[model samples]
Structure formats: C-alpha cells, structure tokens
Target chain A: MSTAEPPAVAPGATVAELGEEALIALITPMLPHAPGELVGSGDDCAVLALPDGCAALSTDVLVEGRHFRAHWSTGHDVGRRAAAQNLADAAAMGALPTALVVGLVMPPTTTVDWVRDFAAGLAAGCRECGAGVVGGDLSAGESLMVAVTVVGDLQGRAPVLRSGARPGDAVVHVGTLGRSAAGWALLEAGLAPRAETIARAAACLDAFRAPRPPLHAGPALAAAGASSMMDVSDSLLRDAGRIARASSVVLDLGEPEAVLGADVELLEEVAAVLPGTRPRELARWWVLTGGEDHGLLATVPQASLGSLPDGARVIGRVREASAQGPGVLVGGRSAGADLGWDHFG
Target chain B: MSTAEPPAVAPGATVAELGEEALIALITPMLPHAPGELVGSGDDCAVLALPDGCAALSTDVLVEGRHFRAHWSTGHDVGRRAAAQNLADAAAMGALPTALVVGLVMPPTTTVDWVRDFAAGLAAGCRECGAGVVGGDLSAGESLMVAVTVVGDLQGRAPVLRSGARPGDAVVHVGTLGRSAAGWALLEAGLAPRAETIARAAACLDAFRAPRPPLHAGPALAAAGASSMMDVSDSLLRDAGRIARASSVVLDLGEPEAVLGADVELLEEVAAVLPGTRPRELARWWVLTGGEDHGLLATVPQASLGSLPDGARVIGRVREASAQGPGVLVGGRSAGADLGWDHFG
Candidate 1:
C-alpha cells in the first residue's frame, strides 16, 4: 500500500513500476496449463475444446474490505476463494470445471510477488476441480478485486436445476457447514492476529480464508439422481429458501437440532475461544446462517436416497408448499427472513 | 454519488436501500433471453448449448474513474463498452459470441435505475453479437467496476491465432479506427459539457462510449482463410506489433497515409473544435495509437484477398523478421516502443 519508490527493483517491483504486460508475464508462467486448450493466454481470446457440446458458466466477484482484508488473507487465499466459489457454482450445476477467465483490478502499490502467488493459488484451486486458468484481464483500481468466471462441461448429462426439487425429495448436503462463518467471526474478534499462536483457531481461520468445498460431490450427486442443487454460498437458510421458492415447495429442515448438531459440534472449540460466546448457540447460528463454505445443498428423490454419494447427509426433506407460500422451515417453524449476508444491506 | 435520503423509495431506490437480491430482481427482467440457453439467471450457473464443441473465451474489466467517469458516461454507456470489448475479443478469435457472465461491483449509493439501464445496454450489446447476458455476480465496492466474460462458438473451424501470420500475407482491417481515441480526447477536453451544441463531436464521443465492432466479419474472415487475426483494442501499431511478435514476422504498413487518410479525415472536424490541437496530426496519432476501437486486424493470404469480406481494408503486409527482431513498421520505419496506453504506466 506504500507509494514509496515502488519498494523493489526489476521483476520484484510493484505493479505500477512493472506495468500491466510485465506483471502478466510474471504471473502467466505460474498458472497450470489447461489440458486441451486450443489457445492459451496472450491473445484476444483463449480457445478451449468443449467436447460435451454444452457448458455451465458462473461468475463470482471478491472485493477488498468487503470480501477480505489483505492483512487477514493473503493473495493466495483470495485467489483460492475466488476460484473455489465459481468452481463450486459449476459443480452445483452438475458439471466438470474446465477453464476460467479472471478479471483482476488492483492498486498500483500491489506487489508482483503477490500477483504471482495469487496466480499460483488460482492454478492450485483449479487443479483440484480439473480446471485451468485460460485467460484474464488486469486493470488498476483503488482496491484489489478479483472477478472469476468459470466454464464447465456437463458431460452429456442434464443439468440439475434449482427448480426441479419434488415434494417428496430428500434434502441432502455435502461438505462443511458454518465453519467459514465461524472463521470469519473469529477473525473479526481479533483471532487473526493471534492465529499462529492459537492452534484451535487454525481450522476456522483457514476455512474463512481459503474454503475447501466438496466440488466432486456436485457431479456425483447429479449422477446419483439429485433433482435440484445449489452451492450454499449465502447461508443454508437463505439458499434453502432460494431452492424452495424456485421449486415451489417447502424445504423442511426437520429436527434442526439433530441435523445441524454435527456441524455445531465441529465448531464448538473454535467458538469457545471467543469471550462471552455460547459455543453451542454460536456454532448453531453459524451453521444455519453463515455462508461461504461452498457446501452442496441438494434435493434427491426419496427412492434414490439410498444411492446418494458418500459423505452426503440427509438433513431435510422437500414438502408441498402451503398457502403461506414456498419457504424454508426449521423445526416446523419459519426460518425468518434475510438471514444471509447482503453486500449493500 | 450522493448520500441523500433513500432517493425515491422502493423500486426507484438506491442499491443500499434495496439490497442485493431486490436490486437483482429489478435488473434481471431487462436482459434479453439467450436463444437455446438451457438455464438462465436465478441459478448457480447458466447452462448454454455449445453445439460446435469449441468455445472461445475472453474477459475485460472497466473500472470507474480509470475507464470512465460517471459524469461523462451513463451507466448504459459503460455497460455497452464493457460488453463490446469482450464480445470483440471473441470476434477477434473468429467465433460467434453466444453468452456472457458479468461480475459487477458498485458503490452502495448507486441508483437502481442506473443498474437497470446498465442491464439494458448489456442486453443491447449482446444482442448485436447474437449473445445474451446469461449469468453474473454483483458485489459492493467503493467504485463501479464491470468485469465481463464472453463465450463464443467456433463453428467447427480452426481458430485464427496471432501466431499464424506468415510472410507475404496481406494485413487487413475492418471497422473504424482512431475514432474512439478522438472521442476520448474530445470528452477529456471538456467536450461533454457542450457535446449537444457541437454536432461534430457526437460521432467521436459515441464511438468512444460504445464501439460498434464489425463482429460479423470475424467468422467471415476466418472462412475466407485469414491466417492470423486480432482485435485492435490497443491502437493499431501496438496490436499489429503483438501479431508480429507472436508470428515472428514484421507487419509493414507500406503506405501509411493511404491506409489511414480516411480515418484522419473522419476525425478532422472533431479535432478542429479542440483548442491548440493539430487536427490532422492528432487524428493521425489517434489512428496510430488510440485504443478501444475494437477494430479487427487480420492477415490473409494474398491469394484470398479477392475473397475477403466487404469493408475489409488492405492496410499492410506481413514480412519475414530479420535479425532486428519482430515488430511493426509504418512506412518502412519502426514503430516506437510502447506507443499505446498502459494502465499502470
């Protein structure tokens, strides 16, 4: 953030000193190559082969201060989160991620090393989901913002839409829940400064910084007959409401305590570290209303429940919508409204 | 930019007052539905059919202040420019654009009507290229930033790459040149305030605000056997240099004046309005180094010249790179280093 003499020389220089092209040169080699890319970066467009004849596309934006603080998260962390969120979106559509195009805006004071590390993390995150960074754009701005658009191949299968959940469908979930929110809370409570010294805070902190979404479960759940699916990016309660509204059904989180108890237990230790915090209550709130874990929330037919992918947890059920309208219910009660994060709100 | 009271209540409210979801609800209906889209907005990802089995991808970012001033450009203008640049990149790759995903960040004070207008312009731009606004992400930030990623179908033809320009090929161009730069200069020179009073400034200003790249010519040029092609988003000399370097050949503008005279004449009236400006010299410079025109620059085999698409101008020729290395030569003279805009520089 310093405007002082660039702080380095040559390849180690800041973005302003190195300029856009040179910075791109330093970052491009750090990215893993796409398997069958017809054309890579340094061109008008990157060409990729989509043998399936169909593509699933999603875009996500991460803004500094609003999404993450540079002090709390590294460039690598931002890159991973940016890529993971979009890749998870693709997975939610029952597709295998193939390529991503990034649009990055940063301050001139940003370091080239940070950009390289960001690219490296993007490559790492994409590699996990069988995707590659095909191309990107760069610009100078007051804050660092990463916008990633990921493309995925559907592999000849019909996409599982959010509106396909049936009345008798079983609502299932795969991957961690509420951990990212807990991590965020911990960070907000100054845990970030003491993270290295506190081993108990590591899990939550890591979750908040670079989420490890169960991306593989997306396509697997679809193949296992998932009728409807979405990534839990904006809290379980809110995203469930989205599915409910889209499918014109009620997503009943029957016996919420029993369904979310495991997640609550997972975050108890981390929650306990915060002063005046009720571990169980805090963990439960995080599980229900916390987002950014990128967990898969899906509905599958009751008949196919037995064939669900491993690690899947049947936590709820789809019910017929009443005169009250489509919504999410927890413990046979309304889950309230707007419990998830809203940027402007 | 105002922090005034809620503006005009619900639906006519500011982004902060309406929140993300409601703002999205207002914008979604304005976009045109993409033809053959299996899934559109309101999903984790949009599913699009790519019958050609190949996809051309490109991303471009436009930041407020850096890319445009709110006082000078309307939200619609920004949206059109953002979509145009990415779509042009796809066109440069000899593909037909099908869909786009946008990642938009705006200040909380932004008006809902502005957002709607932006969406309408995005739809308008995409419609021009046979594409649609499929899916996008929105976030809150200090400045308005639009990041668009476009996907295109290659139609079963080999990609025309910048590296395929061979010696003896004729360099061709299709679309306006330097007019965008002239438009930008006009705005920068306080022409925006008096634009309506000066009919001569409208063309340049419009060109700068929303470029109309001849997208249909891309596939046509490819089918006509263009060896290498790229969009001139960054001045003719600079972009030509990119192709030369990529193909390891020199792009020689054998008769610079003859090739660029028409463009200079087109901008003469606009330049004459600006005090202390050398009309012909400024126009010529704009032609040589002004970017954002989104003009197609291509290299075609001499044998295919007669078959080239309408409006295609033969401006230069490809020549073997000597020991001096690959570059662009104007009138048998070397084009100087870095004559185009560099964001960081």
Candidate 2:
C-alpha cells in the first residue's frame, strides 16, 4: 500500500553523462533472440518472418493516477495492467497474442525492485496471454509510465472490426461492464458497502487495474455469423453508437430493467450514501455508458444467439440504417440521460 | 511548424470523469483498420499470421522533455521520432520494417490536431523508412508520452546482435557519433553555427529528437559477413563495451584523433562557442560517448574489411577474451570516462 519509490538522485544523471551509445551495453546480453529474427536487437530495426502474410497488432499505455493509484498498485500491477490492456486490444481484434515490446519510463528514484517486479508482472501477462517480451528500451521520467505494444497471430481468421454490423443482427455482449465505474463511485466517496458487495466492488476496481478481455470474443463473434463487433471500451451506448455510425444503422436497446435489473441492490446502496435517493437513476448509467470493463459487443445473426456461452446477453439489435447520428434507442425512447465518456470533451 | 496545441477544456470532463473506457471509446472510431490486421482494434488479443513463420519486432518510448522539447519539436516530431527509434531498432536487427503499433498517453488538454500531427510525423518516419503505422491506441495522462512498437521483415537474414563479436575481428563504424551529444550541448548553450552546419547539427538535433536509424545497415551487415554489430545509440566506446563484455574480449579503440581528423574544421566552430576551450576536447567527446545518431557500428573478419562501403572506419580490433570486465581499451588504456545513459543511475 506504500507509494514510496526509490529516492531520486540529486537532480538525476543527465543522458549526456550516462552516454546514449552505451545505453545498449546494459541490455544486449540479457535478451533471448528468436532464430527467425531477421534482425534482432543492436541495429536500426529487428526483422522477423511473418506467417501467412499478415500481422496482428495492438497497443496500450498505463499512466499514474489515471489508470492506477500508486499507493495501491505496485510496479508489478502497473506492468501487468500495461501488458494486459494491450494484449486485450489484440484479443479484441480476435488475434492470439504473439509477442510484445515494452517502453518503460520511471523516475530515477524508483527502486530496482520496482523495475524488476514490473518486468516480472509484464512477463506474467505475456505468459498468460501467449506472448513474450521480445525487447524494449528504458528511460528516466518524472512519473511512472509503461507502454506496451502487443503483436498477435490471427491464425487466418478475418480481423473483426466495428464497421461490419448489419441491420437485423442481434446485439450481444460477452463479459461484464459498468461495474468498474459503479465501484469507483463508491470508493471515491469513502463509503464501504457490505462485506460481499465490497469484495464485489473490489473486483470492479481490479477490473480497472488488470482487465482480462475475452480474447476469444472476436473470433467467436466472427465465426458465429456475427455481422459486426467491437470491444465495449466506452459506455455501451457510445460504443454502440460507433457500431451504428460505422455500419450506418440504428441500435434499439432492450428494456433498461432487463439490461441492468440484476444490479438494483448495489445501486440501492449507492443511493443510500448519496442524497439523491433512487437506485434506478444510478443503475441505468452503469449499463449504458460505463467503459473499461473490456467486454465484447457484437451484432450476430439471431440464430447465433443460442450459441453464446454464459455471462453474455442479447441486449439489443441493429435496426435498419438511420442518419440520426447513428445511436442507441433506449426502450425505443428519447435520447436518454448521458451515454458515456468523451476524451476531448 | 506551429507547435501550438488545442486550448484547455472546461473542468470535470477530465479523464477521471470518463475513465479509461470512455477515453478509449473516443479514439476507437478514428483509427483506420488494415486487411492484414487479423486483429484490429478492440478485444483482449489480436491474432496475426506471417508467411515465413517469424515476425520482426522492436519498441521505443518518448517522454515530453527527456526525449524531446515540445516547444522545439512539433507533435508530428514526437510521433515521427517515436516511430523512427523503434523502426531503427528493427533495422539494426537486419529486419525490414513492416507494421507498427503505438501506445500513447497525453494530457486531456491536447488537441486532436496535435494527435494528427503526431500521427503524420509517425507516418512520415515510416514512409521515409519504408514502413507503415499499422495499429495503435490512445489514452489520457498528466504528461505527454509516446510508446511505439515497430515490426519488420528480415528476408531470412541472420539477426546481428551486440554479442556476436569474435576475437581478432576488425571493429568498424558507419555513421557519426558524438554529433548528437555535441549538438545537444550547443543548443542547450544557446549557440548557433551557420545555417548549413547548424542545419546539419539541427539534423543532429532532429536525430536526437526523431532518430532515423540506418535501416540499411542491419541487413547489409548480415549479407556482408558481419561478425558482430550494434546501433550507435550510446557512445561508441560504451556500446563497444557491451559487445566486448558479451564476447568476453577487449575492444581496443584507436585514438579519437584518427576518427575525427578529417572533420576537424567542422567541429572547430562548435568548440569555439563553448566555455570549455579546445576543439579536440569537444570533438573527442563526440566520438567517445555521443548517442542517437542512429549509425551502425560493426565488426568484420580482417580479411573482409575491403567489402565495406565508403565513410566506414576501422576504429579498433578485438583481442583475446579479457579477464577484466567486457570493456573498451584505448592503446591498451582505460581512462574510463564513463560511457552511455542509464535510467536508474
């Protein structure tokens, strides 16, 4: 729980004194290069042989305070979060995580243990995701940041994107959403729920920390006659809006009660803590716009709906093409309370 | 070019308000997907297929001030530099650039234009290097940081690494070192040479800002029977130390005079402006510990030295494995003006 990093050097060593040329000296011996590496570390580029003439790729970055709380998440947690998020992006594309390259930056005061732990966490994420940390560069910074680029193997399946959705397709979801936001609302307010719920909300917090996306969802949806798909990274409505806009169609979400009805209990707790006294009000926002849970949102043929596994829902459908700025229709009702997050807004 | 970014936004719409999910949503729609993207954006993982059963890979990151000055370099410069460093790394490995995935974190106040310029800069780097920006991700953070992963094709050449040197090999170098360090010092001191040398040094400044590694060196070295090779990211001596350490041999560097003798006039002006007198002193430092020129340093069999192109130098030689740590020697001397940059130091 300590956010204590190693003490910084007095003003830290300038890159000049350390010498840029010698930067490669510390790393060249520790790597295990692939025999197929057309060119490995030590040169301008590292080349490799490609399989079946295709390349799969994804990227993610973990920032201090935003994606993680230094006091709570360890260097390992940060590393895991960085790798997992990027690996998940590749997975969302229906690619099998192949290999990864990491860009690490931290304050000079950071403990070597933190760096070592960070590497271990990265290795763990790579191992679990069927990827390896091929090579990387290190630098000093004012804050801790880890950016990971994950390469993937598609095994020849067509890449799944948000642009392929079609009218008459069933809107389905695999994995949970909105939990992280709901959990944050409670945590930031300094209100603890019942033991079980606190544990559940903590799961939500963990979801934000080290998210494990459904790696198989892209291929599964692609193979299951799904016309279009995308990872639900924004609010459900906002992400759905992307699908609708890309496909030039409309998404008619089912009843709000059917969508987030199961979360009424947690909402009631949040309601108790806040002056505003309605569970329904908070519950609706969670399902509609909550992002970062990394669940899959797909539009599949109705017949494929039966084939979906547990934890998925037939939440809505892709309607005929529409121009009302491609969006989600709640209970076939008015554009309801705000949908999701906006980066530039 | 104008480096002015977008003005700040109203409060509360901050990253925390939208969270990671919402932030990702804002960007997912803007990225263009490629056919080779077996896994595009979205999902836990992406699967890619390569024809030859191997993949080229490398990674690099850019911090706001450490790697570049936002005021000096545009957003495009940041992106181009980010891509160039990684692509150069791939090339150093004798790999042909193929695809790239970027992991970026920046302040929410950043403009869409800045991001575009950054992307444009990256595209320019890839195009100049004959590569492409294949995939990437965007997120919010307090500071601006960029992480890039580049993949390339090696055309079946053996990868050249820092550990491949053998005893009795001729140590050679192709490209300028010390230029970047010297240029950095000049700029920091607020001294400017004539536009031509200034431009050249500015190119060196650009080299440090957005390095374009000698992409051709890696594959060429492998084809030309290079025994060992590495990029001039650190100082020549320090990086040479890595190869020496890995190969358990001594790399005897000739006097700095032998290397910079021809370039004396060009360096004299640079030396005059600095308070520490003498051209040789400043020039010598350039040859010893400078970095980011993206040049190639290689070793070849003494018999095959004639095959090298012009602008190449036989800077030193390898000797019997040394009991002393793997390091550089000057006329069997080790004054040890420490070489290369280190993050934690």
- Candidate that scores best on TM-score: 1
lDDT of 2 by residue, B1-345 (tens): 001123343443555444444444454444343324454444433444444556667777878878777776787778777776676666666656666777778787666556656767777787765665555666677788888877666566666666678888999887666666766777676663442255455655665566666666666766777787767775787678767766677788888777556554455555665787777777777767777776777888877787775667788888876666667887568736356655445
**Cα error of candidate 2 at position B167, Å:** 2.4
Tell me the deviation in Å of residue A89 in model 2. 1.0
Estimate, for each residue in A32-123, the C-alpha lDDT of model 1 and write its tens digit.
76756888887888888877788888888999999999988988999898889989999999888888889899999998878877888898
TM-score of model 2 (CA atoms): 0.83
Which residue runs of candidate 1 sit more than 4 Å off their true CA positions?
A1-12, A195-200, B1-12
Error of 2 at B187 (Å): 1.3
Give stretches of model 2 more than 4 Å off: A1-53, A192-197, A223-225, A260-277, A323-325, A334-338, B1-51, B108-117, B193-206, B302-311, B335-338
DockQ of each: 0.84, 0.44
Q: In terms of TM-score, how similar is model 1 to the real structure?
A: 0.95
lDDT by residue (tens digit), candidate 2, A273-342: 5455566767667767777777788888888887775666888888886555566797886453236754
